[model samples]
Target: MSTSPRGRLVVAAVLFPLILASCTIDPSTGPVAISSATSSGVSLPGATFPSGAPSPTTASSPTVDTSRTTGSSAPSSPTLPSTTAVPAPRIRTSPADGADGISPTAPVTVRAQAGTFLRVALTNPEGRPVTGAFSAGRTVWTSTEPLGYRRKYTLTAGAVRPGAPRTESTSSFTTLSPLQTIYPSFFPNPTMKTVGVGQPMVIIFDKAPVDRVAAEKALSVKTVPAVKGSWFWWDDRTVHYRPSTHWKPGTEVTVSANLYGVHLGGGSYGEADRSMSVTIGPSRIATIDDATKQMQVFVDGRKVKTFPVSMGMDKEVTVAGQKISFVTPSGTYVAQEKYEVKQMSSASYGLPVNSSLGYDSRIPLAMRFSDGGIFVHAAPWSVADQGVRNVSHGCINLGPAAGRWFYDNFGHGDVMTVKGTSTRLDPSDGFGDWNISWDKWLAGSALA
Candidate 1:
């Protein structure tokens, strides 16, 4: 409807109250005025935007338009920086990881790099911790004693940088089994403070080893001032190490078996390393001449005494109630045993006692050389043939005074060499390595 300007003013004033009832006030701008010409139920161009919005030409306008987008809008918060810087820890080990046939005695060591160590632990399969200690500087750690055989061990190490997370590493390994192990029992017993100059170093095995060469290579001998020697195998179970000559009196000898990781074949391995030091006593040797029927005793290479002695009988003798022979086998021998009064019996030697060929007698001042009942003992009955002829059964028959002197002086390891006997002595007849030639003795060595 059209109205004159003057009449419209009067109508406009009356319609103002009614028009104001349908319009809303804008807080940013004062009020929104509505006119009948513009009231078409449609929004004005900039009316949809909130007040104080930037215009199209304003410098504060957003770079991208988001009005046509479907989702609600606010920019996402920027990603923040991490709180701490962490360093990765690294580990190195001895006997290296996954190594096989490791020695039980070898040390297990662990070292960590790039950070201070926090903790380290070594455990067996049962989770029982192995005892260990860190180095003075705290960079490396090692187990205190030998590890077990056929065992699985686990090692865990931890380290950390300042204000950073702890870093850790782990390794696992298995040790050699008992089936791969060999142990050597040494000679001279190591308990004897002093041994004879002629005492050979003996080593006996609990079980026979298949790879004798490998086993021999693991053994070594050292003297204080170094002496030449050779090792000889008596059998699969026994071995001897002897110097070219007797040990120099007062010299120290050290024998070592470094077989920790050595393979002894037949699924046997050396279990652990072993070593021993021994001292040699004075040199004493007795040389018996069967042809002359005399015995010469030497102390440190100086002939000290000569005694007339009648050795083993020319033939087996049977007298009284026993059958006995005085024939002593010819060889180098050690004093196997000694007794003041040893009862002699023919039955012990598989010979029957008969009135004419055998006799049982209790002998005095007896020093033995073999397990077969051969000895240097007093034989008063053969005193007439001491230095003239061999008339008694095999044995070094000495006069009463000479027998007492020899018996008192000679002990377990004294040396005696017998010459001119038809009966050859086996090397094992006694503890007599001197019976074997040096070349032949060396040939017995696996490492030769």
Candidate 2:
């Protein structure tokens, strides 16, 4: 307590060193300590220290920073390689594989899926290629021609897509076999060029069709100056078409039989199609009256000439168990043929040449009109009986002059009407198409 000022200054310098050694500064904590105790056993305000513990010094180990510690980071997931899948090409065919009994007219086709076609082929049993064409994009193929009946066909096709493998397909099929086939033939031969007004359109078949309705539906008739007409079946193999009346002069007629590929029933099919055309000529008609024993010829509704004629004598003879009539049957007939000289014989009608009513001789200027051996010809031996008495077989007896004139004037399909006779003319005797009524003719058609 009794020290001088100089002595106090020396003591102060010595204490300053000890004070600096006792304190330490931590960067993480605040700058001041609170309620710390000094070496004099006194408590200092706002300074903190643990009881019976020494204060921190600058030499203490530096605080380790645990927030940023590093040894090895977490391993990342391995990435999978990127990839894309492609579709393969596919080929399809019609009349599928191993097909049988296919129609010849059936359609044949090939198609590609997810691809374009590379090649396509169809071949017959004979190894010949069938004709076909591919679509614009080369994805489809179709057949162009009809196939043969009872034939086997093969198809081979290939297709491919971009960055994909090529694909191929094959198929085989067989066509149906018909039991029989029929062909049609047209008459008044196509070469005739022109025909009479009363001429009918006739069709004859090599083999009869069981399905008559099918055959009738396949036929068609067209006329320029249209006329109403109907078809009549004369028998199983014959059919005829005629107008309600005689065809008009100058009329053009065309007939068609569209029968190919048509089914005719009972396993039968049509072999081919046919057609014909003909022009109608001027009208020429001949009328005979048995009461007057005269024949009048008319052209276009005007009488041209007349001739006295003697018809068959009214008699009958029995030979070979057949009844032969001498009377000429009465009905309409057409001029079928002509000859300068034709041999007449009774043997053609089942009468023996040795019989009492039998005679064989060469006649002049003969014109046949009936299938029963009836004709209009010259009989100089019976000239006295002309237009006076009937004395001869079933023929119209005319004088030599009249016979030559008639033969020179008449031709095929010229109409001839005969009246006043006991027997009736059969519809089957010749071109008897006109004998049937219109209603009856229409009834004969299968479609009716």
The candidate scoring highest on lDDT is: 2
Question: Worst lDDT window (10 residues) for model 1?
Answer: 34-43
Displacement of residue 345 (Cα, Å) in model 1 is 3.2
Per-residue lDDT of model 2, residues 303-401, tens digit only: 998888888899998876888899988888877788899998999989888889888889899989888888989888888888777787989889998
The TM-score of predicted model 1 comes to 0.72
Q: Poorest 10 consecutive residues of model 2 by lDDT?
A: 33-42
Prediction-by-prediction clash tally = 26, 7
lDDT of each: 0.67, 0.71
Question: How many Å off is the CA of 355 in candidate 1?
Answer: 7.3
Residues 73-187 of candidate 1 have per-residue lDDT tens digits of 1222233322333334345566454555555556566655554455666666666666666766566666655566666666655555443334545556666665645778887
Q: Please give the lDDT score at residue 48 for candidate 2.
A: 17
Q: Kindly report which residue stretches of model 1 are placed more than 4 angstroms away from their true locations once superposed.
A: 1-84, 92-102, 124-137, 169-173, 259-261, 271-274, 316-326, 354-356
